[model samples]
Target: MSKPRKPKGRPVSGWLILDKPVDFGSTEAVSKIKWLFNAQKAGHAGTLDPLASGMLPIALGDATKTVPYVMDGRKIYEFTVTWGEERSTDDLEGEVTQSSDARPTEEAIRALLPSYTGVISQVPPQFSAIKIAGERAYDLARDGETVEIPSREVEIFRLTLLKCEADRAWFEVECGKGTYVRSLARDFGRELGCYGHISELRRSFVAPFAEDTMVPLAELAALEKIEDRDERLAALDAFLIDTGEALSGLPHIAITEDQAHRLRMGNPILLRGRNAPVSEADAFATAGGKLVAIGEIGEGEFRPRRVFT
Candidate 1:
C-alpha cells in the first residue's frame, strides 16, 4: 500500500470578492490569489472576461464548496455599447465585422429595454467559453472554424439606459446566470439597424456579495511587501469573507456541536423542536457561526450532502 501524500500550503477557507481589473483573466486571477494566500485549494464562482472588470467571487479551500451557489446567483453590469461597428467577438477586442451610420436615440433605446427584459433567447459570442462537442467555442473560433452555437434562454431581470450619445450608449443590466452582456450589445446593434459592440464593461455585483466588499488586486498585491510572513498572511486573510456567507441566499439551520460532529461524520441528524424545518430541498447547517454541512432536509432529518472540514 502507498501512503497518500499530504496536501501542501495552508487550508485557508473563505471567499475573496476580487475587483478584477481589465486585461486580467479569471483563471490567472485565481492562480495569483492562490499564490498570495498559499492555500491548498482555490476556485472561482464564475468566469469574467479579460476585457471586463468587476466583482469576481473566489473561494479558497473549503469555501470552494459553496461556489455553485454564487455562480447561479444574479449579476449586475454597467456597460458602454459603441454604435456603428459590430465586432467578431462582440467586444472591443475583436475585429470589425460590420458597420453602419445609424445610432439609436435615447427614446429608442429606452423603448427597446422592455423587449430585452424577462426571459429571452440569446446566442453567446463566438469568443465565449461555451463548449461545443467537448471543445471550447473560443478555441474553435480561433482556429477559423465557425460553429452553430445554440441560443439559450437567459433572464434579464432589469435593463436600463443610463445615457445615449451620438456614437455610444451607457446601460445597466441585472441578469441571471449565462446572460452575456456582449451578446446584448450585439443584438441591440442588429435590432437598431446599427452595428454595435461593447466598448467598456464593468460588473458591479454578484449575488450575495455586496458591491463594496470587493478588494482590488492592487491592494492585495501591496501586502506582499510586509516583512513578516505571518503578518503578510494575516493581512491577506483579513479580506476573506466567511465560508458560510456565500450561502446567504439559501436556507440555513444552526445546529448544536454534537449535531455538527455527526454531520462531519457523514450521518443524518434528526430535526427537533418547534422551529425545526419539516422539509427543505436544500439547506446549509452551521455551528457556532461556522459552516458544518450543506444538505437536504427531509423526513424530519438533515441528510448531509457536502460536509465542510
Candidate 2:
C-alpha cells in the first residue's frame, strides 16, 4: 500500500480578526495570511466584499472547524447611501442603472427607518454570489443576462440614520446572517422616489468578537520586515486568538486531563455532579485551558464529536 501523504506547513491554530481593506477580496486575504503564517489550514467565517472594508474573522488550522458559529453570528455595518442614482452592482463599481433628480429629506428618510427594521423580505443585487443553476449571479450579470432573483427574508435587529446630507445619507445597521446592506440602500431609494447606491460601507462588528479586536492588514504586513524567520513568525503568532475563544457563545465545560485524553481517543466521558447538564445539543470541552472537543451532552455523559489534535 502507498504511504499516506503528510501535509506541509506548521499546524498553527487560532482566529485572526482582520480589518479587511477595501478593494481586497476575502479569498485573497485568506491566501495572503496562509502564506505569511505558512499554516497547514486556513479559512474565513464570512465573505466581505472587495469594496467593503471591515471586520473579517479568519480561522487558522484547527480554528477552521468553528467557522460556522462565527458565520451565523450577527453583523453590524456603518454605510452611506448616495441618493439620485442606483448602480447595477448596488455600489460604485457598477454603471448607473436608474437615476432621478429628486432627493429625500432627513425627516423623510427617518420616517422610513421603522419600516425597514425587523424581519423583511430582501432581493439580492445582480452582482451577488447567489447561485443560479450552479452558476454565480455575478457571472451571469457580467454576461449581460438579467435573471429574476427571488426575495428572501432577513432580520434587521436595528437600523438607525446616523446623518443625512443633501444627496448622501449615512446609516448604521445591526442585522442577522445573509442580510444585505446594499439591497437595503437600493430598496430605500426606490421607495423614497430617489435612486440610490452604496457610496461607502464598513462592517464594524461581528458577534462573539469585539470591534476593537480587529488587526489591520497593513499592521500585519509590516511584521514581514523582521530579519530572522523564527522571530518573524513569532511576531505574527502573537496576534492569534485562542481557538477555544471562538466557542465562547456555546456552553462550555472544563474536564480533567484523563477526560481530555478519552475525548482525544474518540471516546465519551461521564459527567459528574448534580449540576451537570442533563442534555445539550451542542457544547464544547476544554482541559488545561485548551480546547479538547466540541460535542454533545446526554445521559450524564459528554460525547466527543469533533476532537482537536
- lDDT by residue (111-221, candidate 2, tens digit) is 999999999999999999999898999999999999888899999999999998999999999999999899999999999999899999999999889999999999999
lDDT at 63 for candidate 1?
94
RMSD of candidate 2 to the truth, in angstroms, is 1.2
lDDT of each: 0.95, 0.94
Error of 2 at 24 (Å): 0.7
Clashing pairs in 1: none
Model 2 weakest 10-residue run by lDDT:
273-282
Residue 9 C-alpha lDDT in model 1: 94
lDDT of 1 by residue, 197-247 (tens): 999999999999999999999999999999899999999999999999998
| Whole-model lDDT, model 1 | 0.95
